[model samples]
Target: MFDFLRDPQWLWWLGAALALGAIEMLTLDFMFLMLAAGALVAMVAAALGLNLTGQFVLFCLSALVLLFFVRPVLRRRLEESTPLAVTNAAALTGRDALVAEPVTELAGTVKLHGEIWSARPQWDGETFAVGERVRIARIDGATARIERLPA
Candidate 1:
């Protein structure tokens, strides 16, 4: 009754595309996005009566092409459009900190971004009184080297 029927990939291809797209969203990279595009291409091939082997071949070829060629262009464009954000310990540099204890050259504590941080003055005799606002000079290991802001 259905002699023309061949590959049944309606749900398979659609599911693969959705799954890859979701992963791409999490990773924010174009790798899985290219695979999703390939899945869509294979979905079209399947709808056109291509066999499973042909669908698979097209999917691989399309995915490789998109990954190597299209992905770079897309990723570069996106990076060019967005400004880079500082992160990690480097992000704490030059930020304000609230002294939670009397900070001396040796040791103390401060509230940095709602978290308590071990702090020290940059100079040998510099000291920060409790409730003083100091600037983070740099992060050394687990400690934040602080400096008094210019008067």
Candidate 2:
């Protein structure tokens, strides 16, 4: 095995390509995969009896092309295919809540989506009586801004 590698320099290039491909699997960033593709191109050049310098040049050119062109397209496609997830305070907007206490502009309490939350009226001087329904307009720090629901 050692003697065969000495006779065929292309074997070294192929081994390097395989190593890079394995690293690509761990990273999942596509950068190592592009480098692996370049190494494979270098392996082809070595098999065709190109000098070491020529093989190096082929590898560099191939890697650059894949990094600049192919990588961006692949990244964009992956991003576009992924679904957007709503989380945290953004998830509470426009939801319904029940006034757990007399909700006034100053301070109050409500049950929002089964969770007790600090709340305040959406408008100045507005208030909600206990057991009234309200809509969550937005979240402000630890408080929910609420508007009274239509009768």
Candidate 3:
């Protein structure tokens, strides 16, 4: 492994790029893609006969440039992408969730989108029966604050 670092082949840099990209699939955060681009640039530098130190420096510069300058522009462009049809929990304002079990005045749980989540009625003191429909008020950490839906 360390020997490959000394050799600094283009394939090694390309492999690093691919590995970073693969990890991004699980994380879904946009940070890794920048590093991947950097690795690709380093690979090209290595192909051009640059030494390992030069390749590493090129990679660091590429990553820094992408993160500081390119990332914000790309993020802005992607922000206007077509909205997902399904409402993610983070986007769950005014959405409805079914109560899978009775909600006591303090706390309870509900089923939404095939997932069980801790829930609480919006008002200071309230209780809800099972099978009732509730409107999502807001989410606090892992808990969903909700209220009984209007008939």
Candidate No. with top lDDT: 1
Q: Kindly provide the TM-score of model 3 when superposed on the true structure, using C-alpha atoms.
A: 0.52
Best-to-worst ranking by lDDT: 1, 2, 3
User: Which candidate should be chosen as best, given TM-score against the real structure?
Assistant: 2
lDDT of 3: 0.85
Which ten-residue region of model 1 has the weakest summed lDDT? 1-10
Instruction: Tell me the spans in candidate 2 whose CA falls farther than 4 Å from its real position.
Output: 1-11, 25-27, 47-49, 149-151
Error of 3 at 67 (Å): 0.7
List model 2 lDDT by residue over 42-121, tens digit each.
99888877899999999999999999999999889988998888899999999999999988878789998788999998
Q: lDDT: which is higher, 2 or 3? A: 2
Off by over 4 Å in 3: 1-8, 82-151
Clashing pairs in 3: none
Model 3, span 4-110: residue lDDT tens: 45665988999999999999788766689999999999998887779899999999999999998988888777877857576566688688888987877567898
Judging by lDDT, tell me the better candidate of 1 and 3. 1
Q: What is the lDDT of residue 66 in candidate 1?
A: 98
What are the lDDT figures for the candidates, one per model?
Answer: 0.91, 0.90, 0.85
Clashes of 3: 0
Scored by lDDT, model 1 comes in at 0.91
